[model samples]
Target: MEKVSFVIDDALAFIVRAPLVTPFRISTGQHDELENVFIRLHASDGACGFGEAAVATHITGETVAETLENLQSAASALRGRRITDPAAVCREFAPAFADNHAALAALEMALLDLSSRVQGIPLYRLFTPIAGQPRLTFKTDITVVIGSVEEARATARRFAQRGFDSFKIKIGKDEEQDLQRVLAVREMAPGCTLILDANMGFSAQRMLAFLDRLDAGGARPLLLEQPVPKQDWEGLAAITAALEGSGTLVCADESVGSLASARRAVETNAVSAINIKFMKSGILEGVEIARLAAANGKRLMLGAMMESALAITASAHFAAGLGCFDFIDLDTTFFLKGDLSRSPYLDDSGRFDLTGAGSGIGVVPELP
Candidate 1:
């Protein structure tokens, strides 16, 4: 008798620059075109899986060049490894990018995808068994990029027309301007779930002051994300503590890069919730952070970088399998002018049909 080994026979990395439906502005910068890196891995039996990573220098300090370089370097070592054990796949190549989570995430996702496809199971089932569940689908919020009040209002209306009720508004440019933009959206659509993402743009004092006004108005948003800089753990804690009684809950995004960073943010009481992005924290470590969030009574926001449908769909599968995320922002694909791949899990309604069966992430990468 001979033992079979799950050997990865080949690996390839490539980049695709996807244009946004409209100019997207966060506090740190504006993006009309998003450069994304994608990976494909093949097993000895010819089974292949695809993964994606989007670079945002402000969030992950990774550019298209760096992501591809890191992916290529890691892919070289991964080509000949047996991936029956997924954790080992991460351990082998994660070091290529000590601080480059986006690149590492792409590699980790590809390996996970490849392994599951060989076994002919959806990607999430690899993390946890989905033996008995009502359904696996999830609803996600749409993001409204930083813009004028009217522009924000129009964007809100557009998504709402598409049957979306949750919206994440990008802020951190100007305090007053940001507030007015939120108010504009709120006034236009009072019943929608509103999330304000500062993207680490506000000063501690300014953030606190603005929250105070929102609280007084009795319309503080459902959440505030990375109000201050990522390094300002004390500031994050102060804001979270201040909003304890009855105000917008604070969530950390940029502050969480890996399992250590996510754990530290929770230990320091930085925020009430943590935004877990696969691009900022690869799937392997991101799951650990999700466990951390669950144990600490911290809320989870399953988010994504500016990648296409493939990456966001992978993130969604993880979220559905975990069954613990309180919020979902896997809406980056909603803005993509064209999908690098098609995701069967997602529909125009911004929902994931997790019950849909197949192999891997239920995505087919369409590269030009």
Candidate 2:
């Protein structure tokens, strides 16, 4: 790798707690507010870039305080280092920061953003010489968090009226209630495709039974995501095998967080699709996993935690740059109380147009 003529001079970390517009509930718990760590890295040439880490205690097992400490420790190690290659930097730091993947991911984002800015190119351009498209457009699915049946219907109707054609329903709390919520959403938005995400709440048998019930009710979802726990590889494999010719995709989200896990998922045929989230694997590993999944014919879904526009925009650039993702679920920013950050993308209905983005993820934070 050719060495870049820039040295990291300083690093700063900020803790931002933003309230969600509404409670975002999954099988694990509910989140009314999200705490995120933002890292700003300065280069020797007076250029700087930003990165964000959404601290999910249940998902990453790192609280905001722990992530802050981790980021500070990483910043010290990153000082005075020349960024010859951002991916190499990420790999080199992976072992030292193995306990905090989200922290390392934030650092990787800042490094990539800084490097791309230094080169006077969009962040996505650093990954691919040819642009994904002149406009970098992609459609995103809006999520309807776990709620009452009426709430789900109202949410679906509102988003459908706004032009969203896809809905990801959070389920797995009560199979019967979950079925009702799905039916409610489908009734409100009859033509929209449904993606059911249990977030590792159900067992293999329970999920299979639920699928049978759904089929009986004549309500078919396009995807079933993480119906079983993350460690239940056999359960995942069983579900995948059960859905062999059903035209329904079984996706592994929490199960496939890293390259090793993704390889195992592919080898064992645990699921047909893998969800790519930078918070889980960091930017470099996420990209590597995406390539691995694609090469093995596993479908790709780009997703995120409850992040602000900073990380969401970075993810958008990643997805648009690679152009390999089959589904985009980067709509977490909409749950924020207000605009926590700015992106170069224009949202029309569920589609994003990144024609207005400048270099380095094209995201500017509106500090809270």
Query: Which candidate has the highest lDDT of all?
Result: 2
Worst 10 residues of 2 by lDDT: 126-135
| Whole-model alpha-carbon lDDT for candidate 1 | 0.80
Per-model TM-score, in order, reads 0.94, 0.95
Clashing pairs in 2: none
lDDT of 2: 0.85
- Give the alpha carbon lDDT tens digit for every residue of 191-247 in model 1: 988898998888888888887776665557888889899999988998888888664
Which segments of candidate 1 are over 4 A away from where they belong? Answer: 1-5, 129-135, 216-218
**Cα lDDT for residue 128, model 2?**
49
Residues 89-173, candidate 2: write the lDDT tens digits: 8788888668788888898998889888888777876664222443278888999998899899899999999999999999988
Q: In model 2, what is the error at residue 352, expressed in angstroms?
A: 1.4
- Which portions of model 2 show Cα errors greater than 4 Å? 1-3, 129-135, 366-368
Q: Could you give me the TM-score of model 1 versus the true structure?
A: 0.94
